[model samples]
Target chain A: MRRFHISRLIMLVAVVAACSKKPPPAPPPAPAPAPTVNQDSIDAARRAAEAAATRAREAAAAAAAAAAAEASRMEAARADARRKLDAAVYFDYDMDEIRADQAATLDAKVPVLNANADIRLRISGHTDERGSDEYNIALGQRRAAAVRRYLVARGVSEARMEVESFGEQRPAMQGMDESAWSRNRRAEFTLTAGGNPIRVP
Target chain B: MIAGSFTRGQPRGLDDGRAVAVRSYSAALTSFWLVCVLWGLRPSVLPAQDPVASGVRIGLTYDRSGKPGVALTPVVGANADSVRLILGRDLDFSDRLTVIAPDSGDAPVGGLNYVLYARMNAVAVVQAAVTPSGGLHVSVHDVAGKRVISVIDVPLPEPALSPDWRHAVHVVSDSIELAVLGQRGISSSRVMFVRGNEIWSVDADGEGLRVVPGTVDGLSPAWSAAGNMIAYNTLPGAGGPSKIVVRDVLTGRSWSTRAAATNMNPAFSPDGGQLVFAAGTDGFDLYSVAPFTSDEPKRLTARKGSLNSSPTFSPDGRKIAYTSGILGHPEVYIVDADGSNADLLTSSGFGDQLYRSNPSWSPDGRLVAFQSRINGKFQLFTISVRDKSARQLTSEGENEDPSWAADGRHLVFVSTRTGTKQLWVMDMESSRARQLTHGGKVQNPAWSPRLDFSRQY
Candidate 1:
C-alpha cells in the first residue's frame, strides 16, 4: 500500500511536468513504474492517466481553432472596409452638388476612413460629355470638392483626402443617354496609401 | 507705254505717297469694274474721270459685290507642277481673290498678254519663274494698265515637298495677295489642334499634317502671337493632376508648372510675355505666369465656389475674356487683365439653355468667339465687343472650339458635319466653310499668327 502511494505520487508529478512544457505532445508520455500493485488499482490508475491526457489534447486543439477563427474574422473585416472606401458617389447632369441619395454612399466611407488613420484617399471627379472640356474640368472638380467637404464634415481629416478632376476624358459608361451620363458624372475613390489590411471601425 | 519703264524686282510707281494712294484707289476701282464685268452687269458709260488728271489713277469705278479674278501662270522649274498647285490653292483659299487657271496660249514670263488677260476677266496676272539660285521670282502684272506692278523674290530651300519648301511657296502666295489686295494673306500660318491624345499642326492650306513632337497626351494647344511658342495642358495620369506646359517650337525647349492641382486651358498673352491659365486645387480660376521663365504666377480671377476657365487675351492684353459658372451655369464673361470690371458678355437670348463656354477673343479686339449649347447641339457664336451684338457662325452639325485666324476674318472650329469630328475653316464674310482636316478626331484648333519662317530659319 505504501509502494502504491509512492508510484501514484510519481505518476502525478510526471504528468504535471509534461503539461507544463511549452507545447504538450498530442499523445501523453508513458506512466512511471508501479511495484507490487493490485490489478484493479493499476487499471484504474491507467484509466485516470488516459483521461488527463485526453483533456490536455482537447485544450490545445481548442486554442488552435480559436486562433484560426480570429484570423478569418480579421480578413473579412478588412475586405468590408476596403469595399466601403472604394464606393463612388454619383451626381446629376451638369450639376456638381451631391444629391441626397448619394449621401449614404459617401457616409458609409467616413467610419472606415476614420478607423484607418494611416490611409489616404484620392477623390477623382468626372463629368459626362456635354460641355467644353475646360469647363467640364472645373465642374468635375467641384463635384470632387463637394465629396471632400462631406467627408471633412463627418470627422474624416481633410489632410487625408486629395481631389482631382478628369473632366470628360474618363467616363465610367460609354453612351449618350442619361443611363450612361449619370454613371459617368461621379466622384470615384482610390486608395493612395496604407490600404493593405484596412482596419474596420 | 508705262510697262516699258518698269524695272525687274521693284514695285513700280509706289515710292511716292501720292503715287501709292492713286495706285491703291485705281486698284480698288479696277477690282470693282472687274467684278461688274464678270457678273454680266456692263455699265453703258465709263465714269467721267480723266486718268492723267487724277494723278496716275487708272480710269475705273467702284463696287464691292465680286472678287477680282487673278490668274497664276505655270511655274518654270524642276518642281514646277507642285509649286503651281500649292500657290494656286493658296490664292483660292484666301477668299479675297478668285484663282483662274492660266490658258495654254497665255504670254510668257516678262511679255504678258494684258489684252488677252483682260478679256479673260483677269485684273491681276501672276508670273513666277524659278531662278537658278533656288529661289522664286514672282511678278504681278496689272492687266488694265498693262504694267508690272510689283515683284517679289522668295528664297526656296532644296528638295521639294518638304515643310520648308511648302512654307516658302506659301510665303510667295502671301506676297501675291499683298500686291493685289493691300493686305497679307494667312497662307503662311499654321493651325494647332488636338487629335486623340496628341497635338498636331497643319499648314493653313491643309498641307504638312504632322503630330507635334513631344506633345503626347496634350490638349487645348494655343499658339503665341509670335508663332515661336505653344502652350498646352497635359492629360494627367490616373488620380493625377493636370499641368500646363509651354513649349518653344523652334528650340524644342519646354517649361511647365510644378503644381499638384488641375492646371489647364492656357492662353498666351498678346505680347507672348505671359501665359494665363485656369488652375486650382478644387475650383479653377485664371492665373498668369511669364512663360519660359521661373516667375511665380499672378492670380487673375479668384471667385470662390464658382469655377472660372478658358481664358483669352484681348489684342492690347489689357482685357481678358473667359467663361464663368457664377450664375449656376457656364456663360461668357469679360474682365480687365487685373481681374476687375467683370461684365457678362453673352446675352441670354437662347432662353434658359444658357451654356456658353470656350471664349476666344478675336485678335482685332472686336469680337469674342465662343461655343454655346443650342437645341442639344453646340454651335459657334461671336459677340461683338462694341455693340454687344451676337452672330451665329455655324448652324449645321455640332461645331465648337472656334479659334480665329490672325486676320479676324476666318475662324477654325471642330465640326461633325462630315459624320466625324474634323477641323473646318470658315470665312466669316462669306459664311463658307472648307474642311481642314480629314483624318482622326480633332478638336481645340488654335490658329497661329502669320508665322515668319524667315526668323525661324
Candidate 2:
C-alpha cells in the first residue's frame, strides 16, 4: 500500500511537470484571409506595370520607326497613303448635305471599306465654334446622317458605320479666323480597328 | 471664292448661323469711367444708378470703417467693408429694390427727412453696421411710415455661412429683398455652364467659381431644380456609350444610367422626380428617367421617323418644351409631360422661318425663350404663349442658349459678342446685358432654383 501511494505521487508530479512546461505551440496558424486580398491587388498592380512597360516599348519602337522613316524619303508616301486610306468627307458650312464634289470622295471609301470588312468605320461629325452647341449638335447629326446615307447608298453596309457628333468640341485647328473655323467644321473618318484617324485640316 | 475651300475637312460655305467670331464691322468705342465705391472696388459692378423719381426707391447707407475713434476686432476692417459692399450690390442686383450709392452718413435726428425722401421717391432706407463680434447688423426703415421694417444681425463665422462673406450677406440681402418686394431673390444661387470639356459653376454674386466633374467629353450641363446636383452628358470613351451622369455639386456622389447607348441633354423636372433627356438608338427622341439613381428611362416622345431633343420642363411640371426637328429643321415644340398635345411653339415666326432650338421656358410660364437662326445669326428671342408672337432679345451677335433666372426677369445665354462663346446675363426688363464669364468657349448656362443651403453638400 505504501509503494502504491508513492507511485501515485510520482505520477501526479510528472503530470504537473508536463502541464507546466508550455502549451502546444498554437496549431500552426490557419492560412490567413488577409493575404488573398493583397495578392489580388498585387497581381493587378503587376499586370498594370507590365502593360505600361509594353506601351513604352511600343512607343519607343514607333519613335524609332518614325526616325528611320524621316531619315529615308518614304515618309511622305506613307502619309499620302494613310491620307487616302482614311479620307475625310467634308460638308458645306452650316450644311450637312454631301456636295456633288464630296460624292466621289465618299464613293472612294467603298473600296477601302470593302477590302477590310472587319474594320469598323466611325463617322464623327463636328462643327465650327459658332452658334449654340445644341444647334451645332443637330447640324452635326444631320451632317453625319447625310454621310451615312451616302455611304449606305454605296456598297458599304450601314452596320459597319457608327456615327457620332462632337459638335465643335474637337477642333482640327484653333484660332478665331476663317482658316481655323473652316477646318473645325468637319466630319472626321476614324477607322477604329484597322487604320489611323483620317483628318484633313 | 477659294477653290477646294469646301473640300475634305473645310466645310466652308456661307455663314449659316455658325460664326464663332463676331463679324460686326462697326466697332464701338468702349468709354471707361473710374468707378468710385463706398467700399471695395467691385470690378464687374457698374456704378449704381440712382433710382428713378417715379418709383419707391431705397437708399443704401454703410457703416464707416476708417473712422478715427472706432476700433475693430482682430478681423480686418476690410472684411467688414466687403460685407457692406456685397449687401448693397445684392440689393441693387435684385432690381426689385432700386438702391442709390451708399453713404457713411447716418439718418438726421429729425428721422431722415421722411417727407423729403418720399418726395424724392425714396420709400425705404437701408443701413448696415459691422458689430465688434464680426456680425452684420442691417436695418431697413420705412420712409413715410417712420418705422423700422426689420433689423437683421448675422453673427458671422470665421469662414462665414459660405465660402465668403459675400454669400453670407447675400442671405440677409435676399431676406430684405423678399420683405420689400414680396419676391424671393436668387442672389445667392449658383449658375453652372460647360467650359470646354469640363463643367464649371459660379455663384450668382460672381464669386466661388469651381469645376464640377464628368469632364470626359462633357456637354449640356443642366442644373437640377434641387440646386445641389448637375446632370450632364459624357461622350463615350472606354466607360461605354454616351451616358447621362448626375453629379452632386456639394457632395462628390454620382449616379448614372446603366449602359445607356444614347443619352444627351439631361434636364431635370421641376420637382426633381423625373429626368428628361434626348436618347436615341435609331433616331433622337426625348426620354424621361429617374434622377440621381439607377433607373431605366421611359420614352416620352415617339414620333416614329422624326427627331426630338432638348426637353425642358415647365415651372409647373405639367408641360414640357423641347426642340423637335420634325419639320426637317429644329423648332420649339410644347407637349404634355406624358407626351401628348404636341403644339408647335416656334415656326414661321420673326425671321426667315428658320431653325429655332434650345427653348427655355420662363419661370412665369408665360413665354418660352429660344435661339432662332435669323439673318445668318443665332439670336435670342422670346415668344409669348398667348399669341405665339416672337420678340427678338438679341440681334447684334450670335446669341444662343437662353436660360432664365428664378425671377423670370433676367436671362443667361451664350454669346460670341465679346470674342469667345461666353455666358452673358441680361436683365430682360432693363435691357442691360453683362458678360458673366470671360474665357474658354462657355456654353449651356443653366440657372438653378434658389439653393437650400442646409442641403448644400
Candidate 3:
C-alpha cells in the first residue's frame, strides 16, 4: 500500500511539473511501444490502488469497533461504581459511628462522588425494631448525618448530600433476631439527581 | 347497717347489727349537720374524712381499702342487652367499683330492692330504662340508705353498638361512677395508635376500633388536648423528607410542615394551639409550629450533634418533656416551652443501660412515663418530676411508648408480652394490665383526653 501511494505521488508531481512548464508543441509520435506492456502497467497500478483502498477501509472499521468497545467498557465501569455508591453501610445496635468494617465500603464511594460533582445523594438512616419509633428516627438521622460527615471529611461536597431518617419504619429485614436487626440498622444512599455516567477511580 | 371501720380515727361502734344501725342513724344526722357546716367553710379547712368529702352525706360510702360494690340491674327497653353489657364492662373496668351481675331472681320489680342489694353487700345499685325519646334513664340507688341518690338521662344515639351509642353508654357509666365514687370514669376517652402504617382510634374500653380517615403511612400519632386534632409523622417517599402532619380528625382538614427535612414525634400543646416535633438533618432538634397554620416553625432546641425527639407537653403546657441523646445515650429531658431551662429528667449512667425514650408527661404533671432499656429489652418506667425517683411498670416483655389516660391513673402502651406487639391498658394505681388490642403489631398508643361528644370541633 505504501509503494502504491508513493508511485501515485510521483506521478502527480510529474504531471504538475509538466503542466507548469510552457506547453511544448505537440511532440511527434514516437515509435509505438508494445500495446501489451502498456496494458500490463495500467492493470498493475489499478490493482495497487484497489488494494490500498481495501486496507484503509479495514483500518477505519477496526478503529470504529475499538471506540465502541471502549465506550461500553466505560459504561459498565460507571454502573459498577454506581452500585457501590448505592450500597448501604451497616451500624451496630443503637449506634451512629461508622464501623471499621464499613470504612472500605464507604471509602469506595468517595472517589466516585468526587469525580461526579453533579451527582446528588440522599442518605437515609435506619434502625432496628427495638427502640421507640421516634427515637429510632433520631438515631437514624444521626447515622445518616454521620455518613454525610464522613463523606464530607473525605473531600466530598456536603452540599451534594441530603440526610433523612426512616427510623425503624423501613426495615431492610424483618425478624426479631440480631440477623435482621443488624441489617436493618444501616445508612442507605440514593442518587437524587444528576445520574450521569460516572468515572470509576 | 353493717358496722365498718372508718378511715378517720373515729370511735369504734357496737358490733351488734341492730344496735349499730340505730347508732348509725344518729351518727348520720350528726354528719349531715357537720357537712352543712363544712360546706360553709373552705374545703381545705374540712377534715379529710368529712362526710361530704367522703360521699357519706350522700348516703353512699366505701372503705378506702376496698372498691365500692355496685350491682347492675338488667337494662330495660331498646338495645337493653348491649347497653347492659357495655355499662357492666365500663363499671368493672373503672377499677373504683366492683361490679356485680344481678341474678334473674335479683331483678327489680318496678323498683330497686335496696334491702336485697344491701344484703348482697352492694353499696350502690344502677338501674337503666330506655326512655321513649331514645335516651337512657339511669338511676343510681344508695342501697344503705334505700333511696335513689342520682338519676342521669343520657341520650343514646340511634343504631345499637355504634360508636356514638357506645360512647353515650360510657358517659352513663362515668356518671354512675361520679354518683358513687366521687370521681368520673375514663371510659369516655379514646386512644389513638399506629396499626400497620395507619392511625387508628379506639375507645378507652377497647371498643370502637377504627382507623382515622386519611391517615395512611403515619407514625407516632398523638391526640390533642381537646380530642379534636391529631398530630403524626408521615413516611417520606423516595428521596423525600419525612414530614409532620396535623389533622383535625373530625373535619378531616390536614396541615403539614413545609420544611424539607425529617420531621417526626409530633405532640400538640396542652392548649392545642401549637404542635411540637423533632425536625432536622443528621440529628433531630425540637421545633414548634402552629398546627393549624402554615406559618414557619420556631426552633426549640439547637443542640448540635445531639438528637432531640419524642416531645410531650406538660398538662399546663409550660414545660416539654422529650428524649435527648446529648449524653451519648438517649435520656428523657425536660425544657420549658419557650426553649429554656433544659435539664436532664432521667437518671443516667446506671451501669451503661442509659437508653430511655418516649417520655409521656402525666396529666397531673407529677410524673413522666418513659421506656428504658433493661437487660436487652425495653420496659415501662415512670419517673417522679419532683423527686426524680423512678418506678418500673413492666417486666414481662418489651414495652414502649406509654401515653397516659385522662384520669392519670392508667396508661396505654405497646407490649410484646403476648408474643405479638399489641396495645395494653394498665391501671397504674392497681398495677393491673389488660390487653386492649390483639392479633397485629400496633404501637405508639396515644390516649386522648376526656372527649365530649356533644361538642362539635
Candidate 4:
C-alpha cells in the first residue's frame, strides 16, 4: 500500500509537472490542466483524510475527560471517608462497654482505615459533668480504648490510633440529666497526621 | 446499669446546672420566734444539750486560755437590736458556747446587769459597746475569775465593714471565739466558689457576697495559702480546651498557663510556694508550677492512661492526695510530694469500685475528704491517712468538691440534696453540717486560710 501510494503520488506530480511546462506562451494563459486524474475521486479521498484526523482528535479528548472524572470521583470518596470517621461514638453510663448502637459508628470507620494506610486517628474519650472530673477522664479513656480495640479488631492498625481522655472536661451536650449525660459519655475520633477532618489535641 | 452521673452541655460547656441559689429561712425563723413570744413560752435558757440540730455540732470544749463555763451577752449599743442579733447569731453560729439573748435580760443596759450572766452559771461574759469613733469595742470577761480577758476594737470603714455592720460583727464574734477557745474560727475567712460563669465569694458570716471580677467562666477557684491569689481554670472558648490561670485575687493580675489544650484544677501547696494542677497534655495528670514564677511545671504523676486530678498537698507538704483511675475506676490516691509512693487510698474492694475523687487533705494531715458514689448518689467521705479507713460524712445529698478550713476539723463541700446545689460545711467529729450558701447551684468551695487574726483599722 505504501509503494502504491508513493507511485500514485509520483504519477500525479509528473502529470502536474508536464502540465505546468509553460507551453510556449501557455496558450494565451488558458486555465486548463485537467484530463490526467479523476477529479471527483480525488476530492472524495481528501475529505475522507480530513474526517479521519478530526475523529482521532476527538477520541484523544474523550479519553482525557474520562481519566479526569475518575480522579475526581476517587478524591470525593476519600473525602467522604474522612467525614464518616471524624465523629464520636457514645456509650452507656459507668459502662465502658460500647453499646450495639455505638458499634455502628465504629464500623463506619473500618473502610476509611483500610483504604487509606497513611491516615492515623486520634481518639479522645469524654464523659458527662456528673462524676468527679478525674474519674470521668479515666472512664473517658477506657471508652476511647474500647473503641480503639474494636477498630483494631476490624483490621485497623493499632499504631495509627492515639487515645486521650477529656473526661467531663469536654462535653458534647450541656445539662444534668440522662439525655445530656448519655451524649457526653463517648469516644470521639479525629484524623491526625493524614487526611483533613478535625484535629483535637 | 449504674445511672450516668455525668451531664453534658453544649456550646457553653458543662454548665452542670450549678447556678447558685441561696435562701436564709428568715420567714420561718421569724414565725417560730413570734410563736414563742406570743405564747409566753419562750425558753429563757439554752438547753444543756443544746439541740445542736441543722447539722451543727457545737463545741463546748473551751481551752484553759479562758475561764470555763463562760457566758456571753451582747450589750445593746447603738444598733441595739442589730448588735444583739449580729452578736447573738454569731454566738449561736460559733457552736462554741451558749449565747444569752439581750432582750431576755433587757431591764436596762446597766440595770439588767453583769451578775445575771454569772447567775446563769456563765463564767465568761462579752460586753459590746459602740465606741465614739463608730467602731465596736468588745471586752470579754472571765466572770468567775473576775478579770477581763481581751478587748477587740473593730474600726468601721466607709462601707462599714460590709453594710449594716454584718462583717464587723463577724470579726468581733470570731475574736470572741478565739479568746474563749484557742482555735481560730472560719467566720472571718471568705469562701470562693463557682456559681455559673462567675466565681462568687461570700463572707464567712454570710455578708459581703460578690463575684470575683476579671474572670471568664472560671471554675474550681483555689485560694492561695497567703490568701492573696486564686488559681482557677478558664475555658479556651466554645469547643476549645481549658487553661489554668492564677489571678491575684487582690490585684486582679493574670498569669496564663504555659501549656493549653487541657489544663485545670489548680491547687496551691500548703506553703503557697507551688501549685499543682491537672494537665491533659499526655493524659490527665498532676503537674506542679511555682506561683508567679517562670519555672516549668514538674510532673507529679506519670498516670498516662489513667486519669489523675484534684491534687492537694498535706499540711507538711510532704505528701499529696489526689484522684486517680488506675484500677479501671476512679479512687483517691496518695503519693509523696515528689510523685513517689503512689498508692490507692480508696479501695476498689468495695462494690464495683464506687467512684471516688476530689481529694482535699486536711491541714492536720490526718484526714482526707473526698466524694464517692453511694447508692447512686455522690456523698462526702473522709479517709484517714494513717488507717486508710473511710467514713461517709454526708448521706442526704450528692456532696462533692470538699475544701478544708484552717482548723482542719471543719470542711466545706457542695451538696445537691436540696434540689439546688449549695455550699455546706461539716464538722468531722460532731458530724454536724452547716449550709454555708443557699440559692443557685454552688460548686467548688475553697475556704481561705487564716488571713489575719484581727485588725483595728
Candidate 5:
C-alpha cells in the first residue's frame, strides 16, 4: 500500500511535467533526430510500470495486516483488566481462614498483580458482632492479614498491600440476628488504582 | 425437670380461662423477676467449700509505710495497731477463720503459712483545698495500686484530721481485705437517690446522709461509667416536660440535654463515650451522643411512630437493649451499637395490657433486666439473652428502675413495700433483700463501677 501511494504520486508528477504549458524545450531536441519507435522499448516500459504497481499492492496488504494486529492486542489488554476487576473473594462467619474454594480466586489474581507493577491494594477486614469488641477487632485484623499473606506469598509485593480492620463497626448487612452478622464477616480487596499506597510509607 | 426450683408450674388454675389469664399474667411477672434475679446473679454452686478442716483459714496483709516511697517497708507506729485490729475484725467476721497472731521476736518470720504482711504507708495523706465553686483539687495519690492497695486519697477538712485519718485508714484497710479476698472494701463509695424534690447520696453503710441540692425535682440518677458524673431527668416546672442533666458529682457543675420535654431514663455507655436516652418528638425513640459531650446528643432510633425508650448498653458496649412499642405494645428490643439489626426480645402475653419498660443489661451480657407491669403493679424481671427465659424478681410491692451492681451479683431498685417508695438492694441468688433508703421515697439509684480504692481519684 505504501508503494502504491508512492507510485501514484510519481505518475501524477510525470503527467503534470509532460503537460506543462511551457515553451517547447529548445530546438536541441529536433537536432537529435527522431529515433525509431522500437517495440521492445515500449514493451519494457509497460513491464516496469506493472512491476512497480505490484510492489505497491503488496505494501498496502502488509500495512493492513499490521493495523489489525495492533487493534487485537489492545482488545486483549482490555479483557484481562475486566476479568481482574470481577475477581472477588468471600469469607465465612467469624472465620478469617481462607477456604479451599477461594484458592482459585487467589490464583487468578496473581497474574493481574504481576502485570500491573504499580498497582497497590488495601485489604479491609470485617467481622460479625457475635463476640466482644476487643476480640472482634483482633479477628478483623487477622482476617485482613490472612488475605494479605496469600497475595504476598503468590509473589505480589508485600509493599503494595495495606490492611485495615473495621471489626464489626461497618456491616455489609445491618440486621439484629445471626444472619446479619454472618454477612458482615468478610475481607475485601480494593485496588488503589492511581492512588499508589505502595509508594507511601 | 427441676419443677419447683426452676419452673413454678404456671401459677394455679389454668383450665378456667379468666383464672388462667390472671394467673398467666402473674406467672409472667414472676418469670420476669426470676430472670432479673438470675441474670443479676444466676448462681453457681460454690467450689464445694474447699474441704474445710472443721474450721476456717484467715489471711491478712497491709501497707506499713507512712510516707510516699517506692520500696516496701516494715509495719510500725499507729499503722501497726490499725493493721492488727483490721486483721482481728476479718478473723472475727468469719467463724471459719481463727486468728493466729505471729509469736513476738519470731526467728525472721520464715516460711509462715499464709503470711500476714502489713505496711503503714504515709502516702495515704491527701490535701483537698476546696475550689472557689466547692470543687476539690486533690493531688494526693503519689502511689497508685503498685505502691499500696489499702490507702487512697479522700477529701476532708483539716480540723477533722483525727477522725478523717481513722476513716481513711479504715478505707485502705478494707481495700487490702478486698485485694486479698476478691471482694470490695465498700467504705469509700457513695449511693445517690431522689427523695421528693431533692437528690441525695449516702455512704455504702447508709451513713453521711446529705442532700445533693439541685434545682427542679429529679428522677432516675445514672452514674457516668467513670463514676465522675451523675445524669438524671428532672421536670423544671409543673406541667412541663422533663430535662436530662449531667452533674459533676464533686464540682456541682452541670449541663442539660433537651429532649422533647418528655425525655427521661438516660444511661451511659460502658466506656463513657456516649449517652443513650429516650426522646420522642413524635413518639419516644432511643438516641446517642457522638463526642459524648454533655451539650448535644445524636438521635439513633428511627422515628417511626414507635415508642422506643429506656436505652442501655451491653457490658462490652456492642449492643443496646431498649423498650419499643412497635408491635402494638412495649417490648424490649436489642440492636447493634449504631441502631441497626433491631430484633424484638420480649414477648410476655401481658405486654399489650401492661407496659414493659426500663430495660437494663446484666454486667456479663448474659441477660437483660427490666420492669414489667402485671396485675397493675410493676416489678423487676430478667430475660435470658440466649434462650429468652423470663424470671421475676419481686413479689411484695411495686419495684422498678432496677440497676445492677458492678459484680452483677446484686441489684438496687425502688420498692414501695414500706408504704412508700424506698431504695432496696437484693442479692439475686440468696433471696435476701434489705431496704437501702429508710426515711423518704427514694427512686432511681445507679450503681457505680468497682471503686479503685488503691489510689485517690
Candidate 6:
C-alpha cells in the first residue's frame, strides 16, 4: 500500500504541476571556475544536501495541501448528491399511482433540478416481493411513471426524468411480511451531472 | 413474396380472405417491409433437408379466443409485430438455437416436422399437451436421446400482469430456447448499466428497460455472483463520502460505504458476501469490505509507490486481479484474497504493449478479458489465464469493457466501430459479429447466468 500511496502522490504532484501551467527554464550556467581546495568542496557539498532536504520538506507540504483541497471538493460534490437523495418522494404500499401528498414532496425536488441545469433524474420503480415478477414489474413501472409525470408537470423538463422498474429484484427490505415491503415498493431517484458524475440515491 | 404459388382452395370466400389477407398484407405490409428494406436481407433458415441438429425446436400456439384474449384484442396486432421484430433481433443475437417463423397451416399442428409443440393456452397457465405429461401433456422428443424429456405442468404469470404479450413472447421464446439448447436462456436475467447517469436494469434482450432506484448517475455497476445484489460507485454524496453502495434491487433499498473520490469499478466476490474496490486519500489501492456492518473497510493493498486501481475478482474469490503501476508502468497483477503473494501477469513496461487495466475473468475461470491501448486507442483483448497469451478481439474502432457471455463462447463489448459506442457481441468460434443495441452509447454488458432452462411452458 505504501507503494500505491507513493505512486498516487507522484501522480497528484504531476497533476498539480500540469494545472499550474508553468515550466521552469534550464538552470543558469555555474559561476566562473575558481581554484577550490578539497575541504572547501566538501563544505559546498554538505550545504547542497541540506538544501535538497529542505526542498523535499516543501514538496511534502505541498502534497498535503493538495490532498486537503481534493477532500473538500469531494465533500462538496457529496453534499450536492445528498440533496438529491433528500429530494426523493416515496409512495404508499403496492400502488404505482402517486398519492396527493407526493405532489408536495415531489415539488420539493424542483430546486435541485433548477440548480443543476444538466442534471437528469432517474425514477426507479421497485416492488416488494409479494406479487409475481411480471405483475411487480408493471406495477413498479406505473409507480415510476407517476413520479416522473408529476415532476414533468411541475415544470421539470421531460428530458430530465428517465423511468426504470426493478420489479421485485431489488427491495428496500427483505422479508415476506407487509411492514418490510412498504418501504420496498416505491420509486426513488438518481442524479447525473455533466455526463460524467452519476449519483444514485 | 411466397404468395405466387398457393394451391387453390374450395371456398371462394376463404379464397377472398386469403387474397385480401395477402393483398391487405401487401397494403398493410407495415414495417416488416421497412425491416426488409433496412437489412435488404435476413439470414435465411437452414435448408429444410438439413439434418436435425442436437437440440429440439418447439412450436408455439396461443389461444386467442377468450376474455383474456378479448382484453388483449386491440394491442394483439401491435404486440405481435413487436414480438416478431424482437425475435428477429434475439435469434440474430444468440448462437444456440434458431427461431423459425411459423410454417403454413395452423402453427404447431401436425405436418410440421418440429419434434415438439408448445401452445400458449392461457397467459397465466400455458398448457402444452406433450406426451411426457401423460394425460394431456406437452411432449418433448429429444431425437438424440430417442426418449421423452420430463414433462410437468408449468404455471405462467397472468396475462394482465404481462406488459403486453411481448414480454410473454420473449419469456416463452427464452424457455423454448432453453429446452432446445439444453442450456439456460438469458430471458430471466437482467443487465445492470449506468445510463443517463443512473443505474438501470432492462430485460436481457434490452426490452422492458427501466432505471433502478438510487442508480441515477451511478458508475461501475457490478452484479453479485449470485446475481441478487448490485454494487456501484455513486457520484459523491447521496450518503457519507464518495462511497460504494450495495443495492438490493428487489427491495429498492441500499447502503453506502466510504471510498476515495477516484474510487470506481466496484466488483463483488463470487459469493456476494463481500466486495473489493479502489480506495485511498491520494493513491488508490485495493480495499476489502467484510463484516459488512462495519463502517471502516480493511485496506488490502500496501504497495508503497505505485498506483493500483480497477480491482476485479477471480471466480473462486480466492484471488484478485488489478492494475498496478508500481513496476514503472501500468500492468495487470494478481494478489491473494488477504492481500499477499502479489504476482505480475504482464511484464509490459512503459511501452506500447503495456498499460492494460480492467481485468475480468471468464465465467469458467480460464481467460481474462480486458482492454489495452494500441496506436493511442483502446481495444478489447483477451489473455489466456494459463499462458497469458494476448489476442486482440477488435481492431476497427475504440472498443473496451469486454464481458464474456454466459456460454463463454461469445463476448459482448462496447465498441465505437459504428460511430457510436454500442454493445456488440463476438462469437469466439466463428468470429462473426452482431450489434446488440442501437442509439444511446451503451457500455459494460455483463452476461447473466445460464437461464433456468426447466421453466418451459
Residue-by-residue lDDT tens digits, candidate 3, B136-205? 9988888888888999997888775667777888889889999998888888988888888788878876
**TM-score of chain A, cand. 4:** 0.63
Ordered from best to worst TM-score, the candidate numbers read 1, 3, 2, 4, 6, 5
Off by over 4 Å in 6: A1-201, B1-92, B105-140, B143-177, B237-240, B259-262, B348-353, B450-457
Candidate 4, B1-457: lDDT as tens digits: 0000011111121122111211122455435654654554434432333335212432333323232354444354455445544565555555555554322333322333444344344556677777667788777776655667778888755444344355666667778888877765666677888787778887654545677776657777888777777788865454255677787755667686767446778888878888898776434788888867865888888868566878888889889898876776678899998888999888643345468889898888899988888777788878889988878788896888889887777788888877788888777756666667766777778888755532211
> Measured with DockQ on alpha carbons, how good is candidate 3?
0.52
Worst 10 residues of 1 chain B by lDDT: B16-25
Per-candidate total of colliding backbone pairs: 0, 0, 0, 24, 37, 46
Q: List the residue pairs that clash in candidate 3.
A: none
lDDT of 2 by residue, B1-457 (tens): 0000111231232112121221111122111111212222323433233335223333322212210111011112335445644555455566445443322234322245444333323456566666667887766667656676767777665654345455566677777676555677887777788876787877665555667644657788887777867788876567666778887767768888874345788898888878888876435878888876548788888885356888888889999999887886778999999998999988575567467889999989999999988877888999988799988899777898989998898898888898778888888876767666765778888887777463332
TM-score of 6: 0.52
Give candidate 6's iRMS in Å, 1 decimal: 15.6
Candidate 4 segments exceeding 4 Å error: A1-86, A95-125, A137-180, A187-201, B1-83, B104-112, B161-168, B236-240, B348-352, B453-457
lDDT string, candidate 1, B114-198, tens digits = 7556644568888887788888888898877888899999889766667788888888898899988889999999998988788
Cα lDDT tens digits for candidate 3, A1-201: 999999999999999898778543432244236545554456555667898999999999899899889888888898889988999999998899999999999999988887888889989999999877888888888899999999999999899998888789888999989999999999999898876656676
Best by TM-score: 1
Across B1-457, the per-residue lDDT of candidate 6 in tens digits comes to: 2111111221233211111121112333323533442453322321122124212332222222211100001002222333334443344345543322222222222232222222111111112321222222223333334344434334333342243333444444455445545564455555665555576655555455556665665666777776666787654444433467776645546777754333456788888877888754334578888524666778788975355666778888888888776765566788998899998876542236555666778877878887776776677777877887877778888777676666676777778899877777787766777655566756556655543422211
Winner on TM-score between 3 and 5 is 3
- Candidate 2, residue B232: the lDDT equals 86
Give interface RMSD, per candidate.
1.1, 2.5, 1.1, 3.9, 18.3, 15.6
Question: lDDT for every model?
Answer: 0.79, 0.67, 0.79, 0.68, 0.56, 0.56
Chain A TM-scores for all candidates read 0.71, 0.55, 0.72, 0.63, 0.55, 0.54
Model 5 chain B: ten consecutive residues of lowest lDDT: B15-24
Candidate 4 per-residue C-alpha lDDT over A42-123 given as tens digits, one digit per residue, 9 for 90 to 100: 5555667788988988998888888888867766766666667877787887778779977777888887777677788888
Model 4: docking quality category: incorrect
> What does candidate 5's lDDT look like per residue over B1-457, in tens digits?
1011101233323212111111111345435434544454222321122234212432212222111111111223323433333323322222211222221211221221111121111222122233333222222222223232333334433332233333453454344435434455444445677666666765443334567666447766777767776787764244244567777656667777754334566788888778777664334567776322556666787846575767788999999998776764567899988889998887654444446766779988898988877776778889998988988999898888777766575777888788777887776675567666677556567676644432121
Provide the TM-score for each candidate, comma-separated.
0.81, 0.72, 0.80, 0.69, 0.46, 0.52
Question: What is candidate 6's CA lDDT for residue B244?
Answer: 77
